[model samples]
Target: MKLMVSFSRKKVSEPIIARAVMDTGVLINVERARIEPTEGDVLIDVPDESARTVCMKMRELGATVSVLRDAIIRDEDECVDCGACISVCPQEAFSFDSDWKLSLDQPRCVLCGRCIQACPHGALSLQK
Candidate 1:
């Protein structure tokens, strides 16, 4: 599952994430992270079994966490399989099958909206 964690400036520098990783024994894949003086945001992929523990630990450390479900969606009917999104996806979420059909690895998607914008047929969208 994917989690979006927001940190206040006061708690931004804490090693809470490291602790969570060590405690949960799960490899948390950080897809995106942005830190500034006032606030920070991190998008992470957590194992299903450790999601609850990790989220609780994050909240205890004063970071707000939200679960992101279906962050990206594709309309099969609308998609022309032009490979436009494939070229722009930073995560390589979009790919071609053996038959050259477009496929999407939803879990690898970071919801960056690059695929949505790259789709000339307007077949992709980011779900809120």
Candidate 2:
């Protein structure tokens, strides 16, 4: 099976691509440019047709691929340079660039909500 990554932009753009695999718990897509998925992006689930079907249906519906866990935590532009969430993230999922804007690595982010609970501005979200 093939995993199709759909972007919100026009079809002329390249769709995110991944091979089919089983035991994969979550598929994440990051809007920010700082973070990236290099390896081990695939979960250990057995390869199957059902997983492929789910992915296709979600793409057709324009759902952003993410683990249920990560979607619970929120990431937004209002994140101040508080550095609170960065210290507590078990997955080290949160980071900031030179501009001090928060960047979330969706693949690495498990969406534990430590950051989400800590944010005072309430800017973080797991939605697409």
Which sections of candidate 1 miss by over 4 Å? 10-13, 22-25, 98-100
Local error of candidate 1 at 91, Å? 2.1
Q: Candidate 1's residue-wise lDDT over 44-86, tens digit each? A: 9988888998899889888999998878888899997889988
> What are the per-residue Cα lDDT tens digits for candidate 2 across 1-128?
22323344442133333322222334433322321333112222213445555565455544344333245445446766677778788878778878886677665654345777777788766444
lDDT of 1: 0.86
Which regions of candidate 2 are displaced past 4 Å? Answer: 1-77
Candidate RMSDs in Å, in order, are 2.4, 12.9
Q: What is the lDDT for 122 in model 1?
A: 92
What is the RMSD of candidate 1? 2.4
Error of 2 at 59 (Å): 17
Please report the candidate that would top TM-score against the real structure: 1
Q: How many backbone clashes does candidate 2 have?
A: 10
Query: Which candidate has the highest lDDT of all?
Result: 1
Which whole-number lDDT from 0 to 100 does residue 10 have in model 2?
40
